[model samples]
Target: MAGYEYVSPEQLAGFDKYKYSAVDTNPLSLYIMHPFWNTIVKVFPTWLAPNLITFSGFLLVVFNFLLMAYFDPDFYASAPGHKHVPDWVWIVVGILNFIAYTLDGVDGKQARRTNSSTPLGELFDHGLDSWSCVYFVVTVYSIFGRGSTGVSVFVLYLLLWVVLFSFILSHWEKYNTGILFLPWGYDISQVTISFVYIVTAVVGVEAWYEPFLFNFLYRDLFTTMIIAWILWSPSDILEIHPRVFYFMVGTAFANITCQLIVCQMSSTRCPTLNWLLVPLFLVVLAVNSGIASSIENGLLYTLAAAFTVAHVHYGVRVVKQLSNHFQIYPFSLKKPNSD
Candidate 1:
């Protein structure tokens, strides 16, 4: 009943009992991630509305795609022998991807704090994400394929998967039955471990046997981490699934270990961690432009075929009401009739 409150615990399936356990969240990111900048976003006042954050994310994604296309791999080069095209193009593409992901993290925070967490906001957030995936895969694979039949298959299938997910997610939200590891509590260790792994992947120093990041952070791998632990949390509810329960536990442990690692690995030596993601440029780039070979092309074709089938099946299930997703959040939105 206080400050634009909406329905909480809007039950979809059995996720009504979603609890705030140790594994699913971290406390810090829940708050700090919101756009509380000191007069930085000039056009709109900081407090105008958090809705702009959502728009900002979309713009960034578009910018990234455009940058990639303009710098087409046919024109850009990365490393000495790894030459592709224009070096600045790749650099800009990577930087833009980094910016998009970072913005992805901020919008939610701004929404909740500003009490602007509307049904439209949720829809826009998820919709943009799906589109971003679409644009990214299509643009990159198309070029990486260099007009090969194999590349066509992979791009086609990967896109089918994103489309299916987006459709189902919208319905899931409409019915208020999204899968629940829990609700909007930010899990600290889960994110920290992800960042650590990404960092490890970038450093050219030494590649560990099992991807040192993974071996070093078993908790992140095992934990069923989500954005469920940062905000309103309690310890009373029992988990409906054993596997999910354990994942949460592992995430908690991993979060603790990551904090320690940050302390041990920082240049300032103050145990602080930075969350921006320019370092992931190569990974996304890889997804965009895979290497060309007969075997690689064959695999792309197969993946495309399988995903297409999966997309068809998901549509069938939704149409027949054979699916019943359990939603963890108790909040409800008045889904607008699109018809």
Candidate 2:
């Protein structure tokens, strides 16, 4: 509450609202999912805070994470090279993840309907999304058969790093261009994760690790696809449009390298609070790589906890900065004053 500004009920009706523009390219999300979420949004009560929806969705992911930690055989040394995760767990995780995915869209619509849209909402949504990306990937890795090995863990960390980089780059683009340019790969990745969960439930984890034929395993094929996507994704975006390329790939890479430079030089004028982004990301990668090499489940959970705490601190700082810049309360739930 120290960083939060309060608005009286009498002054709640006149605050300006920010427009939301997410450039989604997945055909299902654009044509079907958005409409479904909008319909769900219409039924949400006026007083329901958008931040609550965002937080709830994130909590669901957290729950699934806990479940994985407790039940995943690959997560601990007690069951070395043993995988007995129940089919029901995969089903539950898949349903929860999909619901979370749906709620991610719903929260923005709820904010607009209630006239509570704010930069805090955008930051909160993306912040949770960044963590969710790691959680989902880790969940898959726990069951990935070859995931416990050194090389496999490195590959997993690389994948997660790219995912996080893409998420942060989108925010940097918004800061520079004032548009939330969602990439097509984001939608594809979400759908792929959801599908992986479903497939795991149907076929079980062994199928994923078993050799298909002539020593080629499903995991090998999946890894190849991931690497191929990383290489080809830019060209694919370039084919779609140059502007999309500029925002998604061009600025993304630029931010990865030069964002800290800009932040340092412009801190007096811009005051970017999340200056630790790159450093913390590197720490996470290093820590996870060590854990992977040691196959230490305890260290993995510790890393997760550390990442969560760091991000929460960073998020609060960002919200405070945005609140001051905009002269509005952070995470306010009430309708703005109309007078």
Candidate 3:
């Protein structure tokens, strides 16, 4: 469908009636982070696009991922015979992460400060966040390393899904309630991750390899904290390659989250289960139920490609619609001409 429109005429009309409603009950957000963001946002010139700030922050996190991949491709940095990541890398990552977190907090405020707030800005911000969930978690996993020296990749995969789901659920909540109740876990996770990065810089990754108590290493504590807060299956359904499996899960989650954002922004009713999930669910059932064991991996890879293309296309269309409806450039601060 060359002319597929992700947002309908009704939804486009609803966008005109869209109102941004959100509640931040976390004292950390309200009392601390919000106040700090207010002060920091003043430093940004009004000419800067909030979307620019959002995109820059996202790039920094991606850069961190690249750095980790270069140093610890297998997540075995601390294991014997593996090259250890430098102390400076952790320090650099820590500093960059804090800055990204700050920019994220300040972007919306910057939009409000400059009187350039638009539904598109919120969409842009949250949409990027849906992907950032993967980057930040994967980079953090590099710190602890994978395998016997740290958490397993399979466990990390599961943790990453927990995070992605939490993110999707938050937006889903907004879809139903018409109010985004900002989850308390977000601030806590960001702060803790930043702190861990800095700590690793100071004490070195070796420190984490040691046990905190009762033969339980710091990795155990780290994993426990995440479980208190929020993998991969060997089942026939999960017969696909690990990397392909990760992409499939991540893409599916991103698609669902972006769709929910569309619903929230347009003030429309979100489907209880997005139509995209139907194939994903069926793949799971067919493989595990022994109906498609022989071609399970092929099905997974196909699903991965489909989900990724569908999500990217949906995002582009929705952005195009919103930009046209509002008469604003997606990433530019320039005023639209009346001509």
Candidate 4:
């Protein structure tokens, strides 16, 4: 009686959703705490299929771990507003994304291998993935960089457009549409998250190597990610907006190709380790600065730009490929189905 606040019957009905705070969750070891990870896991019976919930919870754990690791340094403005998602929340989210996607395997294999796949289950799984991807993306902006406002103003548009457009055009060919439905759309979402992890790691390194390198790198690399999404829009919209779709795709692709080339070339040079070049770059920047001629004398702007570009681009491709290979979903709610 010392402190009970009245909760209306309506509020009480929804308590299950918030009852998730009952358990203490760990960043690294989530599988051990099955119920802890799966907010709704408590409801499922031992006999009933628990693969989906288990996987989904694991996905959140993955994201949570990553975000905690990466975004903790900056203490961005967005962390406080996400309710339970604090600054360390990014890592939790990363792990969460990771787990949910990994479970995609159990969901499918159990169905195909165990002969348990159902249309309703498939639909629910996919729907979960789509929503999860959106959640993680939004969380990325919320925890770091400029957080929510920046996402609202810029990030969301590109993400939503690509996703929605893809959803639309995927139906043009039923077979192709089926492909788009991979783990219920988590395929693309996972790809995006993997890319972000790679890029962010590079950015972190840049911040350590030289403060402003990330700022420059962010400009170019961020453009690549956003452009890729925008360019993909045309492919998604061909059915609903054919002519316009082609125009958008054609134009965006050209720009995107240019970007990819520039980025890829720089990326190629990033890890090559040119110790001799560092001093040479510095001399050039020193000579070039003050006057236009002093460009590369002190290894100033040009060298910095070169370093940043390499880190960003290589990360974009290599990490993305690796994620795909491993089936780690960064952007989508899709879980792993391997093994």
- Which portions of model 3 show Cα errors greater than 4 Å? 1-3, 209-244, 272-306
What's the number of clashes in each of the models? 25, 8, 1, 65
Q: Give the candidate order by descending TM-score.
A: 3, 2, 1, 4
All candidates: TM-score: 0.37, 0.63, 0.81, 0.34
lDDT score, candidate 4, position 139: 44
| Model 4 per-residue lDDT tens digits across residues 251-271 | 232222322222222222112
RMSD (Cα, Å) for all candidates, in order, is: 18.4, 11.5, 6.1, 22.2
TM-score of candidate 4 on Cα atoms, chains taken together: 0.34
Candidate 1 residue 150 C-alpha distance from true site, Å:
8.9
The 0-to-1 C-alpha lDDT of every candidate, in the order given, reads 0.34, 0.55, 0.76, 0.36
| Cα-based lDDT at residue 313, candidate 1 | 44
Give me the displacement of residue 215 in model 3, in angstroms.
Answer: 22
Q: Give the higher-TM-score candidate: 1 or 4.
A: 1
Candidate with the larger lDDT of 1 and 4: 4
Worst 10 residues of 2 by lDDT: 242-251
Tens-digit lDDT string for candidate 1 (102-205):
55566655555555454334434544454454444433332233221122332233333343333333333333333323223222322343343344335521
Per-residue error at 208 for model 4, in Å? 12
Which model, 1 or 3, shows the larger lDDT?
Answer: 3
TM-score of 3: 0.81
Model 2 clashing residue pairs (backbone): 12-336, 12-337, 13-336, 13-337, 13-338, 14-336, 14-337, 14-338
